[model samples]
Target: MKKRWVLLVIVAFVAVGCAEPLTKTQKGAGIGTAIGAAAGAGLGQAIGRDTESTLIGAGIGAAVGALAGGSIGRYMDNQEATMRNQLAGVESASIQRNADMLAVTFKSDFWFDINSATLKPGAYTELQRVS
Candidate 1:
């Protein structure tokens, strides 16, 4: 109950942009910690039904989740920059980052032969760049 209220207040403040802005890493940590804490508490209650267990679960979850989240965010940032630099002149492919995942989309029209399912000769070059 107390944790929920504190989370709500923090979310409201962030939503309204009243507080100093959060970087992607900071945002990831906050989100991961909140989600992990909730999951941990629920699991602890289901397994142990004890206060000590719940507190321990929450603490462990918060630490692991925050570090993992920050690391993922940083990895995505670096990958996005690399993709943009590597594919600078290639207009047929697009790269997207959603949360911790990266989506690389290539237009078939740019990579495929007309009326055939064969990959164009030049497409290999772009694919090699990506690799």
Candidate 2:
């Protein structure tokens, strides 16, 4: 039983940890799964009073929680894609998405003249499109 719990924990961590940081939906799912598993295990222990029931409850809860959280940041995903498409031809800017955050960076030299603080005339059109 202890070994099973340890394996389950390891698997959960592995599922949540990947080379790239998780998006909002993935993050939500991981959080939901952990919470659901704990709640289910507690309920199962209280109600069914058996190890088998606890395990079954945990599995069911995890699945439900994952499904519920799957679309948490879907709108952000669409917006990011749209922004990428709109900025496709621009060579002076770049976008980076990390989890629920979206960052857009523009080259200062492209938008400004040397060390001047004012944006170049051509930069307005690009900025307007972004807005």
> How much lDDT does each candidate structure score?
0.80, 0.82
How much RMSD separates candidate 1 from the native structure? 5.5
Estimate the overall C-alpha local distance difference test score of candidate 2: 0.82
Q: Which ten residues in a row have the lowest lDDT in candidate 2?
A: 68-77
Q: How close to the true structure is residue 62 of candidate 1, measured as C-alpha lDDT? A: 83
TM-scores vs. true structure, each candidate: 0.58, 0.58
Question: Alpha carbon lDDT of residue 48, candidate 2?
Answer: 92
Model 2 ranges with Cα > 4 A deviation: 1-27, 40-64
Candidate 2 lDDT by residue in tens digits, 28-118: 7888788788888888888899999999888888887777666555555678889999788899889998656788999899899986999
